[model samples]
Target: MSTQVCIIGAGPSGLLLGQLLHDAGIDAIILERATLEHVLERVRAGVLEQGTVELLERAGVGERMHAEGLVHEGFAITREDEVHHIDLSSLTEGKTVMVYGQTEVTHDLVERRAQTGALSHYQVEAVDPQDFDTDHPHVTCRIGGENIRINCRFIAGCDGFHGASRRAVPESAIRTFEKIYPFGWLGILADVPPASDELIYASHSRGFALCSMRSHSRSRYYIQCNAGDSIEAWSDDQFWDELRRRLPAEMAEAVTTGPSFEKSIAPLRSFVAEPMRFGSLFLVGDAAHIVPPTGAKGLNLAASDVHYLFEGLRAHFLEREDTLLDAYSQRALARAWRAVRFSWWMTTMLHRFPDNAPFENRILETELAYTLESQAAKTALAENYVGLPY
Candidate 1:
């Protein structure tokens, strides 16, 4: 089939981009390797940055979120037997984050698209962007051993890190900036009740632990783990013990930890490509860059990047001014790098080093204390955590 824009991957970015284009009366095709059910249920991030929530509300996909998502006021940073809260609500003028998973966001966007009868091709494979001329780009995809081709005015590589999008760029034009941390986070979503109303970023001598609430009843938590540590190695007992270690003695009683529903370790890393666009194929989301999950910046940054891209496209189509369109990559990178910096900062502050380094632990402890006590430090964390300016 032919369309104005052909989007690879039906993740949040790809699907949202299609919806935005459709609203503008522009035609687009979304290709996904996974089934709709799989995409809708793949659990990931839950924190909704202020800008992301606004984008969803504007797109008319946030009614359920408005009713169901939990609004958080602020989060705590704990160290040295003390916990202090950073008032995110006060810092951001009541612009707080919502506890809604990326899975739910995908479901909402999918339902919205389905309401308009815009069908996306699901469970397809071998999506290749080729035959890029100045005027037209062709996306070749395989379905059930059949070679199907999609023609388009432009191709958007919203497919993530594992997809063909990033490597599709010519080697000469690719400038990859990357940093991989020594630690990974073992994230868990439990059926048991949440231990805290707001997130707690605890820098402990043992390691870092984060207790976050998805709802009043559902708990989502994580701890810094060895990159090679298997979830199989950590039983229910071990998880709770770790959670207790991170919690202060008095707060430990308040923390009613529970059984884990989901468990997986994600390595911490920050990476950004110098230029996010290469000819007709423009990359977005994990396809373009990955921020460590510390600052809760991953999903929100993707939403922000594509939001500007849509604005740029609107200007290109409606006003025929390439001002924003020409500046798309630069505009996106401006916001992308800010989140990158914040994520790196959070990662370094929260995660403990393995070396028998009394010095590093002391330094991290001091930093955490400053973050909790100093209004300026708390404000910086709150500002970045709430959302970055678009």
Candidate 2:
């Protein structure tokens, strides 16, 4: 097989990139290690930055999102029993976030790709990108006991952190920085009305909790837990009880709980790999960086990375320009680091450290108190939460 670009994942990043390139009359093929069902089964964050929403619109997949997604102009933060609201729209001059699940986004993109007859090979095994540093790059994989090779001008490594794309790069050539938190988020999805109109982030002596929603009738909630906590350890009643204890009195009373449909614990971490491009191979999304999710930056950061790479590829193929392609890594990294900082700051201020000293705990409390009390601080928080400019 021959194509202009070979994408090594079927996740949102790769799908979005392929859609943008396809719309621009560029040829790209996507390869996935898992089946389509498995891809949509993985639940993830839903907060959408303005830039991401625009990108989806550009890809012709925004109709469902604009129709069904919730627009959040403000969210609340609770310190013990006191609730403080941050008005994102007012603070950012009408900027707002969209609450659309990642699963829905993927489904829309997948359906559009199928309608357009875009090539995506799923349930592939041992996918590898070869000769990415050279002028001629190719991807090799085994699909259904058949060996296939795709020759392309460029290889997009959107296969994520654990995928083969990042591992293909030599250790000496790339630098990585990571911080693994001592806690995890035990999240549940239930069919019930949300506790509030907008998301509520709570910080208490016990830990941190987040009250979020997928739609008007579907609620998603999370509470900080031990790093080794398992889903089997938490029953539906037990989960609701712990969650209610962390919320403010009013929100606790308003929260409607039922049997959870999905439950899991996700470990928190902040990781970034420098210079997202390696020769003809360009890393995007989780393949290049990861955020702790406190500021809802993980998926947004991936969208930004896609924006940068898509522009570069469009320029290279449409305008016959190489400048954007040459600068892809630097441009993506600049925006990525800002989000990383924001996520880290939010996590530090909101989460209780397992062995934090008295002074450290006091400092975190002061930080949160000041952020809630000062208008300038709230504005800064709102702006970042809504998202930074692309």
Best by lDDT: 2
Per-residue lDDT, model 1, residue 222, is 85
Residue 248, model 1, lDDT? 92
Q: Against the hidden reference, what TM-scores do the models get?
A: 0.96, 0.99
Name the TM-score of candidate 1: 0.96
| lDDT string, candidate 2, 1-390, tens digits | 899999999999999999999999999999999999999887999999998999999999999999999999999999999999999999999999999999999999999999999999999999989999999899999988899998999999989889999999999999999999999999999999999999999999989999999999999999999999899999999999999999989899999989999999999999999889999999999999999989999889999999999999999999999998999999999999999999999999999999999999999999999999999999999989999998
lDDT tens digits, residues 1-390, model 1? Answer: 788788888999998888888888778889999988899878888999988998887767989998989899988877737787788999777878898888889999999999987769999988888866366689898977789988887788889988888877887888888998988898888876776777888877788888887677878888889988998999978888877877898766677767777889998889998688776778888887899998999999999878988887777777888787667788888899999999998888878777738887788767777776788888888889998789
**Which regions of candidate 1 are displaced past 4 Å?**
356-361
Q: How much is 328 displaced in model 1, in angstroms?
A: 1.0
Q: lDDT of candidate 2?
A: 0.95
lDDT of 1: 0.84
lDDT for residue 52 in candidate 2, whole number 0-100: 95
